[model samples]
Target: MRLLILGTGGMANQHAKHFAAIDGVTLVGGVDVDPKRVEAFNTAHNIPNAFPSLDAALAWGEFDAIANVTPDAIHHPTSMAAIAAGKHVFCEKPLATDYAKAMEMTEAAEKAGVVNMVNLTYRNVAQLQRARQIVQSGEIGKVKHVEASYLQSWLVSKAWGDWRTESQWLWRLSKKHGSNGTLGDIGIHILDFAVYGAGSDIDHVFCRLKTFDKAPGNKIGEYDLDANDSFAMTLELENGALGVVHATRWATGHFNELRLRVYGEKGGVEVQHRHDWSKLLVCSGEDAETGTWKEVAVEPVETNYQRFAKAVAQGKTMEPSFRHAANIQKVLDTAVVTEQDRHEHTV
Candidate 1:
């Protein structure tokens, strides 16, 4: 598979490195609006071709697939172009800025008969994969309740650098800069993490989003710090399970962490992923009666990168598909609507 790194941002490096390491795949080209960034990306990754725009890259048209590491707003247009050119797509999360565009991309990719995938990076966690397996196998019976969260402290800590001064992070806190904030950012992640592990799609959602004041007048230069910094949602799965999903940038002390707890009639399952390590725990049979939770062994799962490459090679689409992502985006969009309309929204 000949792949194009569609954006030359920070995350693009991971895409390039992972795809290049695949035995049958090659990084044939790269695309970006910034000349210096794209050139630096190509030089760092040894990509043979670079283009100033997606149009130029498509005209060159040597690659078989695109690793769309573009910003949240750019995914729709670039992905549509790739699909029109009959190229497979491996897109980053949120699929698009909203559900409508994401659905359009999903439908176009499907109609084009091209393999499509979204990089819901949490899917790569072995514990998440095993938790899904356990739920599907009825080991946890029918999941009745779930609790999930994605927590980060970047706002309070300088771990990844100061968002107050850095345009990269500042734009994320501003709506005009094309950022959906924490809910739009990591919300996709924990939503995918929870719903995927529960083995069900969200049926309805109601949410409350909060924006905290940062700096005086909440103004950091040209960027208005109005985007949500924290959010909480009440959701119902298609299987009639009730759950709460939340994410926040104000979660101090923790750098980054995702945890999911699922409870059912017969048993319970829990998965925790912090930084690099993950673990899956289960309580069932007599252990449930005794109130004991034991760790279950789980093997590593194929990453979204590897899966996208394999799908391209095999002419098939896999989990975390474009459709699934669009559905996830529906939930995310619905949450935003609930905040706007002051009521629960359906997914």
Candidate 2:
């Protein structure tokens, strides 16, 4: 299967690298707004074709699917266009900045009979799958509460080269570019992972989206930095389980840290993935608190690119399908609204 990558940034580059290892998948070309970035990506990744725009790549009609790796703002339009063009799509998370647009994209993809999946990257990890198995198998009994967090320090220091520049992180803080900020970015992952582990959907959310000005002198006169840099939420799951979810890009020492703990009436499990290690620890109710926590082995899971390739080849919709992602979008939508209401009431 031939694929066209729709961006030239970091995630796009990772997609290229991962797809290269898949047996039957080939990355035919790339499309980006910046010609130089496209050229650089092509040169670095050995992609043969680099189109300056999505239309040009779609017109070429040589690829069987699209890897939509564009920014949050562009996710909707690009994925919609690709599905309309009859190409299967593997889109990045947040599906869209707007929930309604995300629903439309999923519906359209289903109507087009295209295999669709979202890059909820943790879903690709074997440890998470093992965690889910523990919960579903009743080793943990009925989940009562869950605590999940995703943290990164990149936004705190603002020293990651061009990443801290106004055109980059500032644009992310802007309402136009990325309204949900850390919540939409990493927070969604926390939600997805927690729900996946509990084997349930989020029933509702009470959330607070907070912005800690990372600018020098803690002020940005130009952009309001309206998007959140951190968030905290209380969630209720469909199966009567309660949860606490938090996400922050300002975590001081943590870089790409994601942690989850699910507590059940009879047992509990904890999964942590960070720069140092990826571990899943479990304990049954019979195991005394003083007893050592058992470390469960994580089996190997296929990468998202490999799974997408196999799903396309087998004519099956991939797990974490567009429909599944839209449910997550709905959860985000509710959180956004609840945050706004809280602000309005405080004002």
Candidate 3:
């Protein structure tokens, strides 16, 4: 799998590292809006080529697939371009900031017969995979309710400037950049994992979004800090399961934490990110006194990149396909609308 990576940010570097590590994959080049960043990415990753734009890369780079690690707003355009050129795409999540645009990309990829996958990173966790298997095996009986959250303290005043200043995060907090703030950023992952674990799609949502910390004194240069810093939503799953999701960048103590708890008629499961990738707990049986939650050891599995490479080499459809991402997009879209409607009703 020869690949062109379409971003020069942190995630792009991770992609390059993993792709380079894969036995049958090659990181051909990278593209970025900034030539300097592109140069740095190429140099850092030992990639042979770097281009200032996708057009330039398409014209000169040798690759059969694109790693669309670009920002949320650019995901749609970059992916559509790659699909049009008959290249498979491994895109960062939310598919697109806009649901319709996401649908278009998925439809286009399907018509082009190109492999499409989203980076729902948590699904690659071995414990989460085990949770899915346990749930599907009916050991948990019927899934009844779920609670999921992704928390971060990165936006706290002390941590905000550790990497980049508050000004740098403004783009993520601005609508012009096509970020869904904390909701579309981390919330989508919870939604994807919740659905993956339950083997169901979300059918309805009632959402609320909050911007606790805004850029001081009305503006941070030209960009306004209007995007959500936190979001909470209630969901109804197609399989008749109820769930609540919360995501925040304002949590004071959390560095990066994602936790999910699913309860069923007979048992319950919990997958949490603590010291390790996943800490899983499960309890089964009808008697409360006899059933006690016990830690379940998670076995190792292939990394997401390895699975992607295998799918490419064998010409198999990747899990969490573009269509699956489209479903997530629908959930996000519904959350936005539900929040708006809730606000209007209150007003």
Candidate 4:
């Protein structure tokens, strides 16, 4: 398979590495508005073609798939163009910033009969997969409650201002780019994992969002700063499962700390991120009468990207489809809507 990557950001570089290492795949080229980024990626990866714009890359027309790691705002348009050009797409999450655009892209892919995948990489984590297996095996019984949080200390310190001090990364703080900051960026991963492991759908949500520390002088280009630095929500799921999700960039001492705890009728499961490894801890009620907790063994599994590639090659469907991704997007949309409504009422 020939793959063309759009965007030379960190995520795009990661994708390039994965695709390059995998057999039966070739990294055709990459495109980025930043000439330096494009040149750097081409030089580092030994890619023969480096296009200044996505249009130029698209013009190549020799790729079987397009890996879109562009900003949240360009996800829809870029994916649509790739799908229109008869190429499969692997788009980075939250799919799209808005539900309508996401749905449109999904519909387009479906109508065109092309394979569309979203890079919700957390779903590929070994511990999370083990949790899913335990839940599926009735080891956890009926899932009742879940709590998930993805926290970072990036914006907690003034040093993070370096990225925002430039106009390059400023689009992240803009609402026009879609779904406001870290909520869409990292929160969606936890939300998707929660829904996936619990095997339930969210019905309604109550949310609270805030911008605790605003660095006014930190401007990234022409983008305006109208995004939240932190967002928290309580979700009510379809199966009477209650969930709490928190995502924040302003949390101190927590760098990429993602964790999830699920409680069920018969047992509970916990997954924590520690440095480069994820640890899974499972507990079950001892007996009907005693009602005591006991540790259960959970064997580790590898990541999920290889599974996606396998599924694509074998012509099979992955469990969390773009359809499933769309569900998460709806919950995210509703949470934002609810937060805004409450804010309006308070005003």
Candidate 5:
């Protein structure tokens, strides 16, 4: 499979590295708005072609897939362009930042009969997969509640000023880009994991979001600071399971800590921290009586790009398809709506 990467950002670089490492898959080229970044990535990766825009890259028409790793705002347009060019797409998280655009992208891919995958990488973790298996196997019979949290300390430090001090941060902080910041960025991953693990759909959400130190004594350029730094929400799942989601960029001393706990009639499982070496702890009534918890050693799973490539080669549907991605967007949309309503009614 030939692949064209559509950005030179951090996530795009990560995808490029993983795709290049996969056998039988060729990283054809890359495109970025910044000429220097594009040229540098091409030179570093030994890629023969690098274009300044997606339009230029699409003109080449040699790629079988496009990795849309641009910012949240451009994911829709970039993926649509690639789909129009008859290429499968691997879009980054939050899909399109809203339900309608996300549904449109899903429909376009389905109509074109091409594969569409979203990079909700947390689901690929071996421990999380094992947890899902355990949950579905009646070991955790009839899940009742799930609590998930993803936290980062980046925005809690003085260095947060440096990031917001740039005009480039405007796209991420503004709603016109389709998201309200950390919720759309990291919250989507936790939401996807919640839906995937519990094997249920969220029916409604009640959210409380706060900007905390808005403006933060450090204003940069003329961009409006309208994004939330922290958000918490309660999810009512279709299966009568209650779930809570907490995401923040202002958690001091924490760096990418993603933790989940699920309670069921038979047992419960906990994923302590997903971003690094963490174990899946399972505790049943028997184990609780014994005052012990069963620890499952979790081996890290490989990149989803490899899985995507293999699926394409064998003509199989990648688990958590674009439709599944759309479902995740629906939950996120509900959370956003709840947050907005709360904001409007604030005293």
Candidate 6:
């Protein structure tokens, strides 16, 4: 499978590295508004072609798929274009800025009969995959409760570099720069972590968002620093589980982490993805009677990059498909409204 990478930002490097490592895939080209970035990305990844726009690339039409690593706002137009042109897409998360646009992209991909997948990132965690399997196998009885969080200390530490001066990090703090704050940034991730680990979908939400003062007068030059720094959502899963999903850049001690705890009548399970490793734990059967949680070993699994390549090769869509992402976006969109109206919103 020949692949093109759209938006040669930081995330593009991961996409390029993983896809290029796949057995049957080749990194054909890259596109970015900044030609220098595109040139650098091509050189770093050893991609042969670089284009200023997807239109130019489409005209050339040499690659079979595109890795849509564009910003959240740009996802709709670029992905719609790719789908319209009959190219498979593996997009970065949030799918789009909102559900309506996400649904449009999802429908377009479905109609085009293309392999469409979103990089929910955490889906690559083997522990998450195994926890979902355990949930499905009914080892946990029925999931009755869940707690999920995505935490980062970038606002409190330089572990991710200074957001004070970096465009990549600053843009995420400014709504004018197309950031929905933490909710838009990693909301989908923790949401997917909880729902997928519990083997259910979100059915309702009551959300609250907070933007702490990060700068003098709340202005860091062009960056507004107004995009929410933190968000909390209380959710009702389709299978009747009640849960809370939250994320924040202000989490002081955490560099970056995603954790989920799922509880059922028979037992409970915990899945965690820290910076470099993942683990799954369970307290079920006889152990559940005594509140003893034991670690369950999980083998490494194929990443979303590999899965997208496989789906493209087989001409079949997989989990976290465009439709599934759109569904998650529906919950996120409602979270925004729920925050404003100060009430629960059904998804």
Error of 6 at 310 (Å): 0.7
What tens-digit string does per-residue lDDT give for candidate 4 at 1-347? Answer: 77888999878778888888877878889899999989999889888888887778778787787788998889989999988987878888878878898899989987887777788888767778778788778877887889988888766665445545655446667776454777777778878878776767787788888765465553445665677888888887787888898988777888678888888898888888745777777777565346554444555543445555665677554655667777778777777778877732110
Q: Give the alpha-carbon lDDT of every model.
A: 0.92, 0.85, 0.82, 0.76, 0.79, 0.92
lDDT of 3 by residue, 1-347 (tens): 89889999978988999889988798888899888999998999999987889988887747888889987888999999899988888898879986799999999999998888888888778888898899989988899998888888877756446423455566777766566788878888888878887767888788999986554663566666777889988888888998888988878888788888888888898888743457888988754357778889977878767777787787766887889888788878878888887832110
Candidate scoring better on TM-score of 3 and 4: 3
How close is every model to the real structure, measured as TM-score?
A: 0.98, 0.93, 0.93, 0.88, 0.91, 0.98
Preferred candidate (TM-score higher): 1 or 5: 1
Give me the runs in candidate 2 sitting further than 4 Å from their true place.
158-166, 216-222, 288-291, 343-347
* Number of colliding residue pairs in each model: 0, 0, 0, 4, 0, 0
lDDT of 5 by residue, 169-190 (tens): 4556655545567777787888
| Better candidate number, 1 or 5, judged by lDDT | 1
Candidate 6 Cα outliers beyond 4 Å, as residue runs = none
Instruction: State each model's C-alpha RMSD to the native.
Output: 0.9, 2.9, 2.7, 3.5, 3.2, 0.9
Error of 5 at 138 (Å): 0.6
Clashing pairs in 2: none
Model 3 root-mean-square deviation = 2.7
Model 1's C-alpha root-mean-square deviation from the true structure amounts to 0.9
